[model samples]
Target: MYPDELERYHRQLLVIGREAQEKIRRSSVLVVGVGGLGSIASLHLAAAGIGRLVLIDNGKVELSNLQRQILYTVDDIGKPKVYSAAHRLSELNPGTSIHPIYADATPELLREVISGVDVVVDGLDNWETRIIVDKICYELGKPYVHAGIHGFYGQLYIAWPGKTPCLRCVFPRPPRRGNGDVIPVFSTTPGILGLLEANEALKIISGVGKPLLNKILVYDGKTGLFDYVEIRDADCRVCEE
Candidate 1:
């Protein structure tokens, strides 16, 4: 590590050690969606010094996003999310390389994007995109950190495809939507989950601790409760080939 790089990550170095830190510096991560979840996950990953951070999003920053999307400022409103996030992440950690793709997620695009990446962090809001990402990661044999947030509550887990139950195995299908068809989420909800996603990614990259593999972690900020559930799929369509 360079002298400044070493100094920048000094605090975390003691816990992860120089060898693991080196692995972090050599690893690349793909963060999908630069929304509330993506914003926080990418920020922490960049600060932790992941070698390459690829950000994918096709939306523009909105005034409403300022509530939880900490990566953007008022000036960033109406600008592409990937571009704004890249600028902020670059300023956060010069040692980490930032790659911003201003495009929507698709099967073909995902195949190309997942190439040469070490881990995929799920910052996507909807199940439509996330399921596609999970399938792509499974096909490519990549590890993925999956997380979602809603109404002061959030859930996350690490899925290793063939090794553990994939998202579809756990979900089977998307959960029933609310009557209003609106997700009531607080800003802090995604902030907590996104940071957890970043932490899980770092652990997987550095090989420092056991990844969440088959365990689902749920957080309820309103009640200040955390729950853990073990998950497995005996007849998983995606992983049971």
Candidate 2:
């Protein structure tokens, strides 16, 4: 990062360099669902110097969230995720603009937020919402990064609209909701995947290393093993013709 930008980003530029810093400064990302996944993704992006971040989440912060939603503290309980997240994000980096959309991600809702955004990140709770996001990203020709955490496992992939396969091509259906209830989970799982999503976002924005296009990076926290699954489907409704 340039000396002037360094003065702004400080520690962030030390990690990503000036060029990546500039890209982050000029990019806009819309993150859906400000829970465990969205919380840290927003934190890292804001701290990393992303210019505009639109965070959308309809849920409210509850006491149970304290274990993983590091962005919020006990005092924020009962507050909408968007409001709580925006408050914390503003404190994290005042220079990074935050636009909090306190609503669920429906087709229409997403369309409104998707405008002018360079990328979309799925920090959502369910596969139903993910499919909506995938179609919207495809329609708008924007890159969409998908991240999900189930118990101790988390996965992420960058869906480059028209170039890489969308989430549906790999899973074919939204994962059944509440499956996490049946799996064992540690708070650190989402933390890892959320940062991975942020890393993919930076790579996409920075024109740096190759993105996680068409390949899902799966993390097994129990074993600390990372696996990549190549995904391609010519019949993908969202990204394929």
Candidate 3:
């Protein structure tokens, strides 16, 4: 590690050690979506010195996103999110390579992006897109970190292709999409869940602690309690294929 790199990540080095730090520096992560969840997760991933970071988002910054999306400012409103996020992450850690894809996560796009990525971060907004990410990652045999937030509640899980039950296995069918659904979201909700997602990504890359695997973690900010749900499917369709 260079002198500046060492200084920048010095504190974390104590916990993960230089060898693990090197692994982190040599790792590449594909973060899908750049909204509430993606904002926080990508920031920490770049801050932690991930060698290469790919950010994919299709939307532009809006006035409403300012509440929880920390990566953007008022000036960023009307600008493409991936551009603003990429610019900010580059400024945060020049050593970390940042690739910003200003496109939606189509099946083809997901396959292309996940090609060389070590891990996939599911920072998407809807379950439809989340299922696509899960399936593509599963077929490619890649590790995937999933998280979602709504109001005061959030859920997180990690899937390792064949080794763990995938998102589809846990939620077999997609929830009915409400007509013009606009669920209330607390500003702190995504912030809390996004960091957990980032923590999982780091551990997965560095081989530090267990990576959640098939277990799902749920956070209830209103009650200030955390719970876990064990997930496994021996005859899962996604996993079986």
Best by lDDT: 3
Q: Write the per-residue lDDT of candidate 1 for residues 21-87, one digit (tens) a residue.
A: 9999999999999898999999999999899999989999999889999999999999999999999
Look at candidate 1 and give me any clashing residue pairs. none
Give the per-residue lDDT digits (tens) of candidate 2, residues 1-241.
4565678677766676777777888999998888888888999999888899999888888988878878899889888989889989999888789999887677898998887799898787777888888888877889998898888889888777667766777777666556345334489988899998988888899887778777889899989999998775634664444
Candidate 2 matches the true fold with a TM-score of: 0.91
Of 1 and 2, the candidate ahead on lDDT is 1
TM-score of 3: 0.95
Residue-wise lDDT of candidate 3 within 112-182, one digit each (tens)? 99988999997888998898898888889899999988889999988787678778888787755456667
The local lDDT score (0 to 100) that residue 91 gets in candidate 3 is 99
Candidate 3: how large is its RMSD?
A: 1.5
Give Cα distance to truth, residue 181, candidate 3, Å: 2.8
Tell me how candidate 1 scores on lDDT: 0.88
TM-score against native, each model? 0.96, 0.91, 0.95
Q: Which stretches of candidate 2 lie over 4 Å from their true place?
A: 1-4, 8-16, 177-184, 232-241
Sort every candidate by lDDT, greatest first. 3, 1, 2
